[model samples]
Each structure stands twice: as structure tokens, then as C-alpha cells.
Target: MTTSSPPHDLLPLAGDFDPRTRQDWTALVADVLNKRRAEGDRLAPDAAAEALVTALDGGLGTEGLYLREDRPLGVPGAMPFTRGRVVRDGTVPWDVRQLHDDPDAARTRAAVLDDLEHGVTSVWVHVGEDGLAATDLATVLADVHLDLAPVVVSSTTDQPGAARALLDVVGDRPTAGGNLGLDPVGAALRTGTTPDLGPLAELVREAGAHDGWRAVTVDARVLHDAGASEVDALAVAVATGIAYLRHLEAAGIDPVDAFGHVEFRVSATADQFLTAAVLRALRRVWARVGEALGVAETDRGARTHAVTSLRMATREDPFVNVLRGTLATFGASIGDADAITVLPHDTVAGLPERFSRRLARNTQILLAAESNVGRVTDPGGGSWYLESLTDEVAEHVWTRFQEVERAGGVLAALEAGLLREWVDTAVAERDRLVATRQRPITGVSTFPNLADTAAERRPRVALTTTDAAFAPRRDAAAFEALRDRARTLERAAVTVRTIGAQRDFGARQGFVANLLAAGGIATTDDTTATAVLASSRAQYGEHGRAAVEELRAAGAERVLVAGRAAELGDAADLVDGEVFDGMDVAAFLGDLLDRLGAPAEGDPR
Candidate 1:
């Protein structure tokens, strides 16, 4: 049987343009830049034209072949569901899941009731440490109607006990869409100790006896928090899911039934497009896996749960994290996740206050009810850019999955430290980008608020035991540490000396000011400041030296110039150093703080 091709007009740019036209467009761009250069503009024609083309084309030359292709995304609820699994017909809202981690059982119970009573559709409880103990399951969920509002329990070391406690509460009544959240592989990966999968399998068998309950959870957010790339995280998630399916099959469970027993959890970050693409890619890859296993098309698509990225949350200017969570939640919705959890803005600080928890829940409520973002299925469907990106992400993730399979699967890869090595490399590159400001963390590395008070401290109840496996890390941790050092000083101030007119120095002035403020150093125009940052777009022929000397004469102990080093000329000798893009911002600020007599280590403010 042959399929008919889509109508010519229905295809993207079909017959409307030719690839050869790119040469003509490039020539036209070059001509414009050449004319500008002839008119005495200090621009390289070829370079300027190339940049213009890149800006207009929406793809960088460095992105290689991945950015150049436009792939078709099939209809939603179909095989290889790159678009989505279920068609959300504007009536059913995505599940708004709230996380409950308060260790006080009574408080946790009250909070859970409050959340469910207000807007939360489901509750995710952490059992142990900063979360409630498994023994408190009955107390915390006493008021909850298990059949109406689903409850998900997560435990690090006590999955079996937690599952049993939850099941005991669930007792006899058919569970209404709850997940046992028994993840033995996740526990093993985190603690670097193999957990006996027997209990988990038993729990799965027991849960299988009930309706609307899933036993296994494949959470890839651990890998993501440990600095794994998108592909790496998705690959690990797929491998874990496959491993669970195999294990269950080995235990006399049907393959399709075992597949249905699992759910996937991934991280959603502030990068909306990437988050959406990652989720889309995950579903497609999982669908392919199910197809290979001969599962029905309806059972192939993954049931995804998206949690806001922990690595993206900041302790500094944490209010910005609300915005991040909102964006991530939106991205997750567009990506067609079955459920989403928006972490409280202050989560990185300590146990979240009532207000923070309310805000976290309300964020999803507002998106679903107010903005009506859930009114459409696969909102990003049919967009050329999203489709192309989704396909690219799926390809890369499948390749990584293949590598893990070749290495004898996820557990073997983890035991051999190959997964950690991959994640560490990604972490190193991410750290390098963060340090150099290539990947600017909004509150910590970019527009830092120096005058903002520190986040309120809360005594955390220990929840999970730390192990030697891939540890959680935040991209802003190093930068926040530098700021901590600066905060210890009685007075941390840097003078920004502007040269030439406002237009000439405005950009560099702001640049140097933000850089200094990022390290908790206030920028001042006062002569009392010991350090001076000279900012200018003007050439440093003679005026630059005079500015540096003037700062030195005005009680400045160290002088720094924010401009090209080559332009410093004779002023290079007068200034302590140069500040520019791609510089080690943390190191530069640390040295500056030390030179300015930062308080000794362990000295209290």
C-alpha cells in the first residue's frame, strides 16, 4: 500500500523557495555590509554579513547539521509520539502535584490538606529526613481521600516500608490514580549500593492487583541534578525503564504489563524550548522501545512527570526562581507531561515556608486555570523549530541509549563509573560556562542584588542518606560561595570610573557594575573605595592612564580597566588588571576581595 503525499502547499515552504536562493541572499547581505564599510563604518564586511545571516536564519554555524534539518512530527496520540501521547481536549487539566517534605508529621498533614483543599490535584510526599517518616504516612494522609486525590510517596532507603505504609492507608478501597513510587534502581544509583529488587517486584505485583496505580518510577532528575546533559538524562531514564521491564519479565510478569507498571520522571528547567523538546523526545524514544517489544501503540507512550530543575534554583535572589518555575511548568505542559511539580522558590534555602509552598502550588494553578495553558494538546506541535529540535534531541538520546545498552545497560554503566564520567564531563563544561559567564545564572552570575538580605535559615530534618554515587550539584554554587566571602567583609565596595560620554561608557559601566555586584561588591562613585574599575569604550591612549592615575591618587589601592587589553597601551602598567568577557569571574572577584582585606575565614558577620 502506498501513501499519498501531502498537498504541496501543506508542506513547509514547498515549491515556494529553492536552496540555491541562499547564495543570492548571502550576496545581498555582503553587498549591504560592503556599502556600510565603504561609508567608513569600522566593520568587517564578510564577518558582519555572516553574523547578520546567522541572526536572521536562527541557527549558528557552530550548531552543525542538527540545526539545518526540519523533521515531521506525526499527529498527537499516534505511534512514535513526538507530538504527544494523549489529546488534551481542553477539558482535563494537567495534574498539579505539590511536594510535601516537612518532617513534622502533623504539620505535613495539615499542609497536605491545605494544598489539596486549595488547588493541588495530587501530593508527592518524601518519606524520611527533611520529609515525613514512613511511620507518619497514616497520620499525614489521614484526612486525604486516597480514591479522589492521588498521593505519591518517595523514599530513598525505605521504599518497601513506604510502599507498605501507603498501601495500608489505601486498604481495600480501589486506589484512584496513585503511584507507589517504588524505585529500587533509583535508590541503588543514588546510594551506590544494590537494593534487593525483590520487595519492589512484590510491591509491583501487589499494585498490579489494583486499578489506576503504577509501581515503578524511573526518575532521571538525579542525573540531571548531577549535571548530566539532556541526552544523558533521557538515556539513563530509558535504560532504567527497560531494565525494570526486563526484571519484571524475568519474574513472570508480561512484558507489556510490566511496561505499564513504570512511569518516567525528568527535570524541567527555565529553558522552555529545551525542556519541551526533551520531554517530547522522551516520549518518542519510549514509544520506539515499546514498539520493539511488540507492545500495543496505546501502551507505548510514556507517562511523564516533570519536576522543576533543582540545579536551576538559586538561594540568591530566589524570587527569580518563581519565574523560572513558571517557565518550566509551562514548558512541561507544552511538552505534554502527565503531571508537573513546581518547586518552591526557596527550596534551595531550606524547608519551605507556608507562603513559599502556597506560591509553588498556585504557580501551576494559575497556569492551568488563569492562563488556560492546558486548553490545547501539544501546543508546540506543528512548529518547524520545535519539531526539528525534538527530532534532533530524540536522535541524540537514542544514540546515548545505544551506548548504555552496549555497556550492559544502566546498572553496569553506573557500576563501571561510565555514567558518572559522562555526567562529570558535562558538569565540568557547564561549570566552565557558568564561571566564564557564557551561561549566566540570572540572580547569581548576572543581575545580582547585593543589598538583598540572605535567605531565612531553617533547620532541615535529614531526609536522605548521602552516598558515593553521582551527587547533586547546582550551577550557581561556586558563584554563591564567592559572594559569601564578599559578604563577610565589613565593607565591600568598588568604584566604577566612567570615561568619555555616557553613550561611550554606558555599556562597560553596566558590565563592570554587574560583575562587581555579582560578587557582593557594591559599585560606588565615592573616592573612599579602595578598588576602582575604569570603564570606557574610548581608546586608552592618554586619557585611560590619567583615569587610572587619578583613581590611584584618590586612595584607590587597586585599579582595574574594563576594555580590550590591547587598547590599554601605557595604562596597562597603571591598572592592576583587565576585565572582559570570557574571563574567570569568580577568580577575579575572589582575588579582588582578598586584596581589599576580606574578613578571615570563619569570621562571622
Candidate 2:
């Protein structure tokens, strides 16, 4: 059959304009920078033009421009799989794995079957501890078609039991897909135990008898929840995987078979571009490791399952988490993950209801069916930014992996507190970024809806444990703490004393109000309130100072100016403190909450 020519075929796309060179772009950047430059202050042309570049962690960055690729990143389903490890054959590019954690076997079974009937391709069940009982595994899977739909099981401290229960459900099935979810290093990291590789022998051997089930999983979500950077997570995964491989080798498994026995679970967040890049980077780096081990080309690439980050979910205004999940799923699919699980939006709130699970399942479904995001192979493959970013991540992963190895592998790194130090540093930086609202979390720290009622869910069973080597850290935790305490305050309303008209005070007023509401405190214009804030558009030293003094005299115990403390200048002493952008919000809110009055018992947060 012959095809008709498209409209663009008849025209030269950029015909009216000359091709713009980097030099021309640089000149324009320099001109723009000149306006922001002070009088008589000059910058070198190159430096001025390069100021548009952005700095990211792991020495990775984005330039004002990326040169077109001089070298090709190879095709999909091949060695070094930078583009992708596999080219999907259908519209649904990845497995839709739904997580089930309800302790009720009947409840979990119903949700599992419902999800599968809708769109979920696999099930990852939490067993033991606070989740479904390991003994009840059969009850949960009795209705499930084990051969057709894979069932993976994870436990806090009972992998052997979980695996045994899962195996019983499978019976003599010749074809099954899913992992045993075994990670000794991950367990050690979480429980602060010494590394245990003894379980690999029995588990790996038993898993070999099953056609599609893998016994090992390198779950980097442990580090991700602990606030490890993307590079740190990847590096830890590599180190952990290496440690596993060595153990498997000693257990007498062939290198080729050993590689197939393992899979990876990566944490995907709202940063979609970085999420995709990190996955692609994992493939590139792992492929090289396999090559060095003399493993075959096809077995080299890691099997990846992307999970929407647990650490990114907010307890307050959790509806925003739906958007975060969508972005994560998009990134995971475009990066060619073998499977993906998006946590329910209300995950942090409590046990997710059916509504939340349905939304979670349909998230990937709509992305595939409606958006057709899965129609193409490696959707982000050819972009200059993506390719460059992937390379940058792979390089950093290798460097960090080498560092971990030099410190005596993943276990030793954990024992020596090396890994903890790495996570702590990254966490502090993340805390700073989140606290300053530099990386604004919508509906949490930014644009908070104080009047909105909190989403309700069934209370989940809580699990106690030994002191964890790496405790989970959430970006919104600090702000949420403030919000929690603000709710418990005896006097929850603070007077926002605006200076001049709404326009005069609108921006700062809005800013101050939003900031206060995030902590669950209400705002008012009542000058008789104990705490009064001068939100203004007028100059602080000129029009704002008198308003602060008036508020102070009107039974107001404390007065605040909502502008730069520096801008306050001579009027600084007229008010208690300044409320401005880049201020330490947690600190500011914390101090304010303390001044207002403590909760009935103590600080609830």
C-alpha cells in the first residue's frame, strides 16, 4: 500500500530563518545578563552566558544548551541498553504491579482479584509483621491464578517463611513470574543487623525449580526512603548486587544463571526526568558489570521494577500525591521498567481504601490506554538532555559503587557507618531544599489548603522494630510536623495586620497566610490577637513600621514584618522578626508556634 505525503513534507520547516548557532545563543544570554548586572560591573562573555546552567547533585548539571549527540546510544534490546533493555511488543509496555498489605486475608484477596481484573498484572504482597500473616498466604492466593499472574512476597524479618508460603501457593506450576523479594543487605540496613547470606543457598536453589520466579531482589527503595540521592541509591544497589553475586557463586550457581536470579526495585519520584535517567543509567552500568564478569550480552541488563516513592507521599493534602504518582509512572514506563507499582495517594494517611487503589491501578492503565505513553520504545531515548543525563548518572553510579567497594562492600559500608554518613548528608541537603521551599511541595508547604478536611483511611497495623540503621525520611515531614502542632495550639489564629491596600500587602499577605496555614494555624486581621504579622507591599522602613507599632500596642504580644529582615533596616527592632522567601520555615513556624502557646498536653508534632 502506498501512503500519502504529510503536510510538513511539502514545506521547509525553518525556511524563513537562518540556523541559530551556539555563539548566537550565547550572545543573547550575555545581553539578557547585562540587564541584571549592576552599573559598571561586567562579566566575561563566556561566564555571563554560562550562568544559565543549573547545578545538580553528584556533580551532574544542566547546561544552557546540550550539543547534539556525536555518538549513537545503540538500539533497544542490545548491549549497554542505554535506550532500553527490551522493546515492548504491546501497547501496555510494563507490568502493573499492585501492592496488597491488609492483614485480612479475605480483604486482600478481594483487592488482589479486583486489581488484576481491572489492570494489575502482578501482585506484591506484604507478609508477616504488621501485614498479612505468612500462614494466610494461601488464603490470599487461593482465588488468584498463580500461573497466569505472578505473586511476589516481602517480609520484614521472615523471608524464609514468606518464600515458603508463596511456594506452597504456587504448587507445581511450571510457569510463574515474580521475585522472592530477598535482600539480606536491605534487611540489615533496615534492622541494623549484620549481613546474612546464608538464606541465598536454599532460596536460590528452590527458585531455580520454578520457571519464572526469581529469588533475589536488589531493593534500593530502602536507601531512597532514607533520603539517598539517585546516584547513592544506584550505587548501593550495585554494591548489594555484587555482594549477592559473590554469595551465589560460593553457593555454586553459574554466573549466567545467577544474573537471572536477581531483579531490582527502584524508587520513582515526582522528578520524572531524573527518574527515567536513573533507570536507564542502571541498565548501562549493570550491563558493563555483566560484561566484566564474562556474562552473555542478553543476560547483562538488570530487570527493573519501579515503585512510586513512599518517602515523597505527604500526610497533609495527600491528593497532590496522585499527580506525583502519575509523573512517576510516566517516567518508569518511558524508561522501560519491567514492572511498576504506584503507592496509593492516601498511603501515608492510612490503609488505602478501594477508591485509592482503583485510582492507583487506573493511573498506569490510562497512561497506556489514553495517553499511549507506552506505544513507543524507550520514549525518552533520543533526547539530548535524557541521554546526557543517563550517562552522567551511570558515571556517578560507578564512582560511588567503587567507593562502597573500597570500604569493603555494602555490608561493611553499613557496619562502618559509611553508608549512613552518605544518606545523612543527602538528607540534610534535601531537608534544606524542602524547608526553604526551593523544591516546593504543592499542597504541603506551598499553596496549603487549611480549610480542606483531611482524607480518612482505615488505620494500618503498626510494626515495631529494633533501632533502624536508616530510618525513612519524607520531604514534607518537617512542614507536616508544623501543621500537626499548629492544629493543637491553644490559640490557633494569628492576626495578619496588612499595611496599605490589598495590592500593597497582597503578595506578602498571601505568602504569610499560606505559610501559617501550612502549620494548621488560621489567619485574621484582628490586631488584638496575641501574634500580629505586618504583611505589606509598601516599604517596611516607610509604610510598614507604623503598622507594626500599632499592632504591638493593640494587646498584640508579638509583632512580625513580612518582608526581608534586611529590608526592615532601622525598623527591624519595631517588629519581632521578618517573614520572607528563603526563610527557615520550619524554624520560623516552630518558634511562632512556641510563642503562641503549647498544645494542651505537649507539642503534638
Candidate 3:
């Protein structure tokens, strides 16, 4: 029978209540009173009386990621289109843009072709020692049908020759399109070289001179990856974009034309919600920039392209990198990016192996074809949570952008080391959290075994740092020591086999619970006939023995332990029926409901 305590017994009333109440009404009253008192004392007393009046007066509200009554971005699709989407018939799903940095020309060409064949539509050719050189450029780009696939070329130097070279192969083709990027500021900041601002501004004009040509204004992702927060990255990007516009305006291009030709490449990290919000906020911030330049909002949304950031990619357990990439890809698509890039999982080390690149491409294919993620237009559009966060972040970015403007634009801010200082603060905070494991990386910080001996092919970049030697240090010694200690505690632990129609079912549940308990086997309630849900702590030595004895008494036999196929000894034996391993949740749930005589035949939701 269901047992619930009396409402009055849950808290104490001002007067007396019956002691025989089953719902703990008295305790409820006490809790309510305590919470009310705590909340009353917690808020600032000075702002209390007039808070509602001020809120009604539009003192506070949402702006992209910030709130207010006055809208700066304008309504969706309307000119100065900052408040919403601009495409007349909804945005085209963001393209699956992958990066290829293989030094081998033929191999890199084949890799790019493979991604295109597999449904990826855009590619970014990395700059520096790892990227294609003018010598290897032709061979690497020879068979590239730009009409079928767009290419984004990035270089460390301000020289647009390589991009120009790549573009020459497809020369002014109507269907051939992409961004020409040479971040002099980013390169100078990275290499401590004097930025050639004049030539760089010239390249913007020269590239935009071609129809369908997008000359990138900022690659602020470098700062974000190097340890800048969303606000810092957005602020720098906005300031940089403004500086570029002014520079172009002085170079004889109208500010409107400058904004149209320039696209801001942003970071789409692991924080899915944040990624979505930041992308939306990016459009708003840029819209505000346009408004400041006296341009309409609708024209602004047409100019942004969001690139998924690879900075959050971890070298450890490279597979987890796939999950992060998928999430980032989805976030970008939902956030309405014109294009998105999914970095290979092993990108942190060096150039990705063919296997990693294939996995990355297939991930997008599965999401678009199988998962149908592409079918939805702006999946996060009108989401309250996303809208609120977007407004908050936009406001934060707006404030910081203003600060940079006050510091005399991006170039001046960087010259004054203001940008660097802000980036340093973000990096320091990330480093601090990572050190304490408060922001732990799964296979990196929790468990690392140097001798695992699994051959891993990683991305190759010329850049190196002393921090790479031991940063994000995993506790190998502690892992082994804990494993050793577990051996002694085995007497209390019980191995459980949870049977389910789907193989991953029990394993996922068991893993979640075991992780929550820190260690020890925890089984799911889904078994053949009976169910078991016990905490890891509850299954200690003597307690485990008693629990097992009780299970034995309850008539359980031939228990199938739920775990990865790698961990399971006899996967075939466990698959006694039509049990699918790692089956889709929708299909699995459909089957489960059908068996319960409440079939889910419509809408699937």
C-alpha cells in the first residue's frame, strides 16, 4: 500500500495538530516556516519594497541572454534582425563542417572527399605546419568540387594567398562558397608578432570583391580555447568585428557592406545549453553592433556562421570526445548556425587517424539521417530556458563589449593587454577547478593507466606547451591503490546480472547507480522476473551476503550481469532472446509499452 505522511505532520501549524496524522503535517509547517524565514532574511532588504515597481518600469528584462523591456535585436526576421531568425523560410540546417589537417596531400584530399561523400558539406583546412602549403595545396585540393562542397581556409599569417590559391581552382563559381580567414590579431597574439593590419584590411576588401565570398573578421575561438569564458570571447569578437568594420569603412567600403562580408567564427564547447545560448547571443550582439552602426537587424542575422570549438576536446578516452562533438554539433544546428564543424576526437594529440575522421563524419550522418536532427528548424527557438540564458549572456557580452570599446576597440584593448588579462582570468579559473577535480574530466582526471597500451592516433599541431606534459593529471596511483583496496573489500560486494530486453538497458542503469555510489556493483530493477535495487553501501560484506541469500530465496537463477560487451564474458549466452544491444530509446520504449498493452503507435512522444 502507498504510505504518505499527513500534510500538517510535515510542518507545524500555528496551533496544535493531531499527533496521529500519517503525513507529517507538523513537520511540513515547520519546514515551510523555516524556508519562509530563511528567504525573508536572504534577499537584500533595501531593494524589497520597490522591486516589483522597478521590474514593471522595465528596469530589468531579457535582451539575447539578458532581460529588459526595450528590445535591441528587433523581432525575428525583421530588419536589424537581432531579436529573432532572419531566413524567410526558416534557416537551412547548419552544415556538417569537419576539419582536416593531414600533412599527406592525397590522404587529406581523400579524407575531405570521404566526409563529403558521407554527407558533410563543408571543411576547414587548418593553418600552420599541419595545414596545406601552396606546394601541397593543388594536389590536396585537386579533385575538390567546390560546387558540391564549400571549404574554409585558415592561415597563421595574414597572407590570403593559400585561400586565394584554393579559390582559384574553382574561380568565382556561383555554387563554390566559404570564408577566407587569416586572423592577424590572433596570430600576432599567439606568436608575439607585429600584426600587419593594413594588408589584412586590404584582404577583406579583395576577398569581398568576389560575390559569395565571406571574409572572416575574427577567430575569437582561439581566446576561448586558450581559456576565455563565453563573455570574454563574445566581447572580444564584438569589439574585433567593430574594429574590422571601421577599418573596412575607412578603406572605402560601407559599414553595411563590411558587416555583410564579415562573419564571426565562434566557439561551441561541451556545455550544450550554453553553446545554444551563446550562438543565439552571438547573433544578438552582432545585431547590436549593426544598430550602433545604424544598420537594420534583419541584415545582421544573415552574416553569422557558428563553428563548433575543439578546445574542449580531451585526449583521454578519445571516444568520449565523440559524444562531446555530437552534442556540440546538435547545439550548433539547434542554435541556427549556418555551418558547424565537428573536430575529430583525437584532435588534441595530432592529426586524426582515418578511423577518427570517419567516426566524426558518421556522427553527423546519424544525427541528420537517422536521428533527423536536420528536420527541425531552430529546435531551441522560443525555449524559455534557452531564451533567458541567451539574454543573460548577451547582456554580459554587451557590457564587456562596451568595456572593450571604452578601451579603444579590440586592437587597442589587446595592445593594452586587457584582452589577455581577461583570458588569463578565465584560464586561471578553469585551471583551479580542474586541479580540485571539481570540473573533472572522465578518463583524464579520474582514472588513467599509462600502461593500458591501446594504440591511439591523435591530431598533430605544431603548437606545444609545457602544460601539456602533466596538465589535467589523472590519479593513476590512486586508481591502482583503490583497485587494490577493493580486493580486500570484495567479501561484502555482490556481482549482479540484470536482465533486460535491451543489453545497454541494465548496463546504463547499473553504471549510473555505481558511479553515484562511487564504486561497488549496483544492479537495476529490470530483471527476468524479479527486480533488485540496492545501494553499493547496502551490499557491504555481511550485508551483501544477506541480500544475496534473500535473492536466492526469491527464486532467481542464471542472473545475467549487465555491463559493456567488452566486460561481459559471454554476450551470446546473455542474448537468449531477441535482445538488442544499444538499441534506440524510442524503439525500446515502444516495445516495452506494446507488451504492457498500451502501445505507443502515434507521435512516439
Candidate 4:
């Protein structure tokens, strides 16, 4: 049998200027800049001009590079599914899965009921240490109809106990629509100890007996929170799923059936396009895996559960997290996830209060219901940029998957520490970028609220069986620590010595003030300040020098210049340091606080 080619009308056509390449665009930009210089228009600096060219050419870095050759993206719901698995019409919206890990069974139950009563369609319960115990399953899920509202349980080390408790509550309900989420491999990776897969296989077999229930869950969020890149997360997920398939097959289950009992959980960050592309690429990779196993395309599509990235949440200026969660939920919806969970805004700080949880739930509700984002299928499908990104991500992830296969699969990699090594490198790089403000975290690294009070909430209980090998990390942790240090000081304000009028120094003043505030330092214009930050534009060099002298003469203990240290000329002699973009803000703040004689880390003011 031969398959016919796709219709020509359905394919994308080349534009009239198709022959024009990125090089041609670069040349044009250079020519325009030169012409502007000749016309005495005072063009942007050389560094800034080149940066613009790079941004226009989509060549900022590996993450920024994308090719146009991967266009058209094929049809939605087709093979490889780079667009999506199914063309969603507006009738059915993506499931809003609210996560509940409150240790109090009563509170967990109330949160669940409140979510279901509002807009949530599914419940994800954390069962184990630091969360609801297995014994509280009955109380937590008391009125939750197992046959109607799907409930996914995340049972880390206590899988067997949690499974038994949930099974007892579920009884012999054939129509129960929920997932057991028994992931031994994930637990092992998380806790640095191997679990007995024999129970896992048995649980899979038992859970497979029910309808609309998945037995094993491949949680990429574990890798994600541990600082894995998107490609690494996808590769690890595929390898994990493959390992589970083998486990179930060894236990007498068919490969196709084993695949059916698996689900994927991934992290969705504020990078909406990257998040959507990663999800789309995951489906493609899974499809290939299914094909390799001789399964049909229809049986290969993955059921994805997307959660807002924990790495992106910040304790300082927690309100910005609401916006971040909104964008992440939008990305997940665009990526065509089966269900999405928006973690509470204050999740990183501590156990989220009712108000924070409500905000998280409503973020999804507003996007799905009011924004009408669900009405369109593959909303980002047709764009040249998104399609190109999707294809590149798929290729990169597939290559990583092959590497994992060669390294004796995910389990071996995790045990050998190769996976953790890769993730640590990525995490370090991400932290560096966050530190330098190359990737500015709105509230943590930029526009921080120095006056913001600590969020009043219950402290999160520690998990007893945490793996020191692959412990979860937050990108904002270092900055938050600096901020915490700042909060302890009795007097930690910096004075901004504006050189010249507001127009000359306003921009630099704001920049310096925001940077200081991010480290928990307030800003003042008084002479009583321990340090004075001199702000000025390039044209006001003399003014800046005089201001620095004035501040020093006025008995300011230390003076810092804002802008390039070299641009300050003789003014640099009067300043203690320079505050500018790409500087190590955290370290600078730490040194500043110490020099100013602020209280130490544990000191109570």
C-alpha cells in the first residue's frame, strides 16, 4: 500500500523575498547604520548595534537560534504531532488540576472541594512525609467522587501504603477516572535510593484494571526543579517511560498496554514559546518511541500534565508570580497539555495560604474561560518562529534521548550521576545569568520591593527522605538570601547623589535604586546614609565627579558610581565601586552590607 502526498494547498508557500537570507538582513542593518552615521544621526554604540543585529538574526545564543527551513509544521493531529495531538475545539477546555499537599487532611479536603466547586476539574494530592499521610486518604477524599473528578496521587517513598489507601477508598469502582501515579524510578531519582519495582509492576497491573486511570507517572518536573534544561528533561522523561515500559512488559503486560498506563508531567516556565515547543516536541519524541515498539500512531500520543515552574517562583515581590503563573498556564494551554497546574504565587516562600492558592487556580480559570485561548487548536502552530523552534527542540531532544540510550538509559545515568552533573551545569549557568541580570527575575533581581513585608504563612515541613544527590533547587535562592540578609539590618539605606537635572540622572538613579532594593537596601537622598550612589548620564561627567566629591566631603563613608566605571573618569577615584548591568549584584550587595556594618545573617534587629 502506498500513501498519497499531502495536498499542495495545505503546504506553506515561499514568500516573494524567499531568497533573502539572514546575511542579507545583517548587511542591510550595517548599511543603514553607516548611512545614519554619515548623516550625523548619532547611531547606537557599536556593541548595541551588533546586539540588535544578533537579536534580529535570531542568533543570540544556542537557545535563541532557530532556522526557517523547519517551517509549515505539517497538519495538526497528524503524525509526529509537532503541532499537537488533537485539534481542540472550544467545547472542552484543558483540565485545571489543583495540587494539594497540606498536611492537614481537613484543609486538603476543603481546598479540593473549593477548587472543584470553582473551576478545577482534577485533583493532585501529595501523599507521604511533609504532606498528607496515606492514612488520611479517606478523609481528604471523603466527598470527592472518584468516578467523576479525577484524582492523581503523588506518593513518593510510601507508594505501596498510599496505593493501598487510595485503592481502599476507590474500592471496586470500574468507572473511576484517576491516576495512581506510582513512580518508583522518579522516587529513586529524587531520594537517591532504589525502590523495589516489583510492587510498582503489581500496582500498574492493579491500576490498569480501572478505566481512565494511569498507573505509572513519568514526572519530568523532578529533573526540572533540579535544574535540568528543557532538552534534558524531555530526554530523561522518554528514557524513564521506556524503562517503565520494559518493567511492565517483564511483568507480563504488553508493550502497548504498558505505554497506555504512563503519563508525563513537565514544568512550564515564563518562557511561553519554549514551554509550548518543549511540550509539542515531547509528543513527537513519544510518537517515535511508540513507532520503534511497533505501536500505531494513535496509541503513541502522550498525556501531559504541565505545572508552573518552581524554579521561576520568587519569595521577594511574590505578586509578580501571579503574572508568571498566568504566562506559564497560557504556554501549557498553547502546548496542548491534557491538564495544567499553576502553583501558588508564594509557593517558594512557604506553604501557600488560601488566598495564594485561589490566585493560582483563578489564573487558569481566567485564561481558559475569559481569554478564550482554548478555542483555537495549536494556537502557535502556524507561526514561523514557533514552528522553527519546535522542530529544533525536537531534534535536540531526540539527540539527547539517543545519548541517554547509549548511556544505559535513565536509571543508569541517574545512578552514575551523569544526569545530575548535566543538570548542575545548567543550573549553575542559569544562576549566573540570574545573578548578572542577563535573565532578570522581575521581583528578585529587578524592580524589587524593599519595603515588602515577609509573607505571613505556615512554614513548609521538610521531607525526611530527601535525596542530597538531586535535591530540588530554586534559581532565586541566592538573591533571596541576600534580600533576607538585608531585611535584618536596622539601617541599610543608600543615598542616590543625582548629578545634574532629572533628565541627566533619572534613568541611572532608578537603575541604582532598583538594584540596591533587590538586595533589601532602601534608598534615601539624605547625608546620613553610610554610602552614596552617584548617578549621571554620559554627558554629565563633570557633574558626576563634583557630586562624588560633594558626597565624600559631606562625610559619606562610601560612594558608588552608577554607569560604566571608565565613563566616570576622575570621579571613579572618589567612589568605592561601580553599579551597572551584568555586575554580580548579590555579591556586591553582600560586601556592601558587610562594609556598612549591617547585622549578620542570623542577627535579629
Best by TM-score: 2
Assess each prediction's global lDDT (C-alpha) against the native. Answer: 0.81, 0.83, 0.58, 0.79
Each candidate: RMSD to true structure? 5.8, 3.1, 16.6, 6.0
Candidates in order, TM-scores: namely 0.89, 0.95, 0.65, 0.89
TM-score of 4: 0.89
Q: Is candidate 1 or candidate 3 better by lDDT?
A: 1
Cα displacement (angstroms), candidate 2, residue 529, comes to 1.6
Worst 10 residues of 3 by lDDT: 52-61
Q: Rank the candidates by lDDT, best first.
A: 2, 1, 4, 3
Task: Please estimate how well model 3 matches the true structure, expressed as its whole-model Cα lDDT.
Answer: 0.58
List of clashing residue pairs for candidate 1: 128-463, 129-462, 129-463, 130-462, 130-463
- Candidate 1: lDDT of 493? 87
Residue 490 alpha-carbon offset, candidate 2, angstroms: 1.8
Residues 1-605, candidate 3, lDDT per residue (tens digit)?
Answer: 89996666544564585444413434444454455566546434223322322110001223222222333433556643433354423223556678876777888889877877777777777655546665676677667787767777777642467656655755656646777776666656555555665765666766776767777647777677666787787788778777777777887888987777667778776677777777778887777677777776556674455555656665445677788788887777667676666777766556778787888777766776677776665566656656677777778888888899898888887778887677666666555555444555555443433223123564455543233111222222222233333334422123343333235355454443333222212233433232233222111344334544455466542222234444443432532222223433223223322333322234153
**Candidate 2 weakest ten by summed lDDT:** 596-605
Candidate 2, residue 274: Cα displacement in angstroms equals: 0.5
Clashing residue pairs found in predicted model 2: 504-537
lDDT of 1 by residue, 1-605 (tens): 89997766555756776555545555666676677465665445345555653110011112212233455557888888877888876766688899887888888889999999998889899885446789999999999888789888887778888888888888888657688897787776666577567876788988887888889888998888888887898898899889888888888888888888888889999878778998999999999889988999987889999999998888899999999999999999999998999999999888888899999999988888889998988988876667777877888888889999999998888777878888878887777778888788998899998766457857666434446666678888988898888878867888887766667678888988999888888987787576778887667877877777787788776777887666656566666767575688887888888877743334363
Off by over 4 Å in 3: 1-75, 79-85, 88-92, 172-174, 447-455, 458-461, 464-605
